[model samples]
Target: MVYRDYNISIVVTIFISLGLSIININTINSILIFGQNNVLSDVVCEKPGIKSISASGALKSHPPKNVIDGNQNTRWSVSGIDSWVQVDFGEKRNICEIDISWYKGDQRSYSFVVEVSNDGKNFKEIQSTRSSGTTNDFENYELKDSEIRYLKIIVTKNTENNWASINDIAFNMNKEPDQNLSDPKTEPESPFIPTKGYGDNIAVAADWSCGTPAKKTVKNVIAMEPSLLVVPGDMSYDNTGDCWLDIISPINDLVRITLGNHDVDEGNPESLAKQYIDHFKLPNTYYSFDYKNIHFLMLNSETDFDVGSKQYNFVLNDLKQIEIDPNIEWIITVFHHPIYTTATKHSPNEKFRDIYHPIFDQYDVDFVIQGHVHNYQRTYPIVFNGHNPDTPIVTDQHKNTYVDPTGQIYLITGTAGRQNHELIGQANYNADQYKGFGFLNLMLSNDGKTIKGVFYSNNNGEIIDEFVVQKTGAIKPINPDRNYQDDKNDQDNLQSNPLDSLFSDILNSTPRYK
Candidate 1:
């Protein structure tokens, strides 16, 4: 049955209370509720039973059984890190989402991994993520896995204390689609038809060295299964980049990387850069690629990017050409070093900002993603301030949404589980920052008129930051005399990329992956 009223969402839980007399716990199937003005039709209200539960070791009063008792007040607590709670669902089911309410989850974040098993002996990792530190309410974690009988939650650590505790846990299974919803002849009419998601997404990160701290982050990216994977730099800090490459082998060919300071081995290049270049089959140290409607310019921060330099001229001409390209609607520049960072470990790069920022603004570069700071930060759509590089002129005042924003937005997405660098510098034009393990997922709308950027924390369902840009609308004009123009005659300063032709054949050659 379709539910049009917003209150009908309560029908999901209310269905159990309304029809418990006729329901059978032994059967797991969706009930077709007859109703008018529907939204979610053929909703599944039955959940499987928990046969048995065991924990690494539970407190005397708060036993593992408390988790299955369906009481939010009671909980199961363990001493500390690596503590686990396992459950047997008696039979296999197509699990898709898990809901968990942690003890004092509103106060602190809990880092945990979910593993599932079919046979009681072997378990496979389903998800390694954290809890939303802001809520004690049940946080729903979506999954995409086949039938599984056993489930386990391995608590890595908690931010607040040495206790790994949980108030409640539940699972949602993915049911077969309703025939009416699947058949083209029986398609229903609703608002969803027009706004359905067909947008392409690119997952980006940096400082992803192979370690326990980085494992969860890498797994999270694999689960995202983005159309493209771009790494700004600092892939493997461990001498050879093979370790990190092996971990991300599933999406190796689709990954494009920039040379970070670490990737260049602190002034010593070649070996480390070669690993990523050879492994991923990059065309050059710096090149351009077009994926869907978004054009990506891979800038090498380790090399010469100064004014009148080869790198500078390449960037100038690249932006100039992309400006006239009718097919390209969005442009993103990815590099290793952040020019506008407030992190004390690596403060802002004054020369880099003055040289490149205005150029980015000139070409209407929508977003810039950088690494090297080992944290996440984003600036409001701001134009370069010639008076003081530290202070940029804010073009759009809005925080999370933009309507054809005037200036360019810069982001430091180095939070790939490597470690958080301390932010000791002044927060002059900073918007927000997150010192956690995560990556940026930039999504282009199906209509090709909008783009959404979401910074997702590794393993946790927490979205550190989110923004939407309606590119089709008129740009909110900044100052009438605002100077974003920076022109350079680099017609002669051209380097040919055998891979990226005039039309940027990169998008055509590679089979796009989801």
Candidate 2:
């Protein structure tokens, strides 16, 4: 009896050792998707009542923390690393929207690739975009209805501004897809295309003078997808010694050139203007282009608005016809001189304002964007030479420090390749001065709900400044309220400012431009 008992005990011990060896082999094969930890098995943790699973197979009781440290969230800030985060739906769930929020200051550009896997070994890329990029805000995406057990978001580019402080991310899942959110009335199709297509209908303001930086700026803008480039003035810094042709020859095929102050004269002042008129193929130094129902008025700031000139007569005739286009929802006038500039480095051009503001006001022009101050400033939409508290002005006049109400929306987006001027810190604009060499990316959404102006550095692709203009129909002009409240003109009701108490999330730490 004792010998038989010993034999059974030996057999049981051998079987137990074999099971242990099999378990160890499986653990070694499991790979980690992020961090240094090994992957936990789904089968071992799959209890009958488990709801959700995080990176660890333990019961995920709390949501992920909003950790903003660069090292912790390095995926949000830099490039060349394949950093990623994963979300498990517990079971096959239909996801429609994903809301990812960053700290109020962590704006940067990076490409996002989303993937799904039932077995957690393979992933498929869905949608990708080069975000003009957003800082300190939430980016919401309405994805097509998808059933995903494990979802992964891989960050290809590092978040530029924030040290990687991503706050909270929520995966919105529904039993049934909400048709309203699925097909948003406001959201338009993707603005950027995979090919060498212009991102949107808006134009890029470029100046190819001041050496290679200008040439690089033009090429980068073309790559980013601009509908067209509007070189309002100053194609080159100095035209002396016949260097103008060399500077413009390379980019001429890519962009439509417009004459600027430096390009017209400086060396051969007598015939320089004629040389500019002949080479650029412009219709007498001023012309217009109609695209997707938007009218772009490219004017010569030197001639038309300078005392009495021939270009002035041409501008008058051009406005007469543009004003009558009922289909033209937006009128964007580009030039070199600013109508209302608060840059202490350069004074506002009273001469240009007197020449153009009347026509702009009479026609209810949507926006007037110019580049020449070598610094950047935007004014609220106010009438010319008028100061009303209710009016919108871009100057830093109010003690509250927001967009001026009683002024027109004027922008000086000049620093394409030229050196940025030091901001003069004074009482009026001491708090809101940005001196950097950068360019502007102005986008008008197809729905006409928002106008986004993105200011990125010329040297490196750093987005320095951003602002949005919300349109209220002709019913209310210079409304100081925050929200766009609708009012019946006959009923005498008006809404408040759409953005009453908002501030910019992106800070000016290292000025991106030269």
Candidate 1 C-alpha lDDT tens digits along 1-514? 1111111000000001111222111100111111111012222335567789898887798878777667788888877557788888898765545677777767776666678898978988756556657777766443332467888877776665566677665544435432112233322232111122246667888877664445556656666667878899887665477778887888776788888766754222455567666776666677788886778888888777779977787788888888888888888889988888774556566778889988887788888889988688988788877787777877655556666678888999887755445566546567778776767877676377766677876534356777766665455545636543221123221232222231132122222212
TM-score of 2: 0.49
lDDT of each: 0.64, 0.45
Summarize candidate 2's per-residue lDDT along 88-202 as a digit string, tens digits: 6567655443445433333444444556777677777643432325444444433333466777655444334212223444333334322212223322232212232112534
Q: In candidate 2, which residue ranges exceed 4 Å CA deviation? A: 1-203, 206-208, 240-254, 304-310, 386-407, 426-433, 447-449, 472-474, 477-514
Q: Say what the RMSD of model 2 is.
A: 26.3
Clashes of each: 5, 34
Displacement of residue 478 (Cα, Å) in model 1 is 5.8
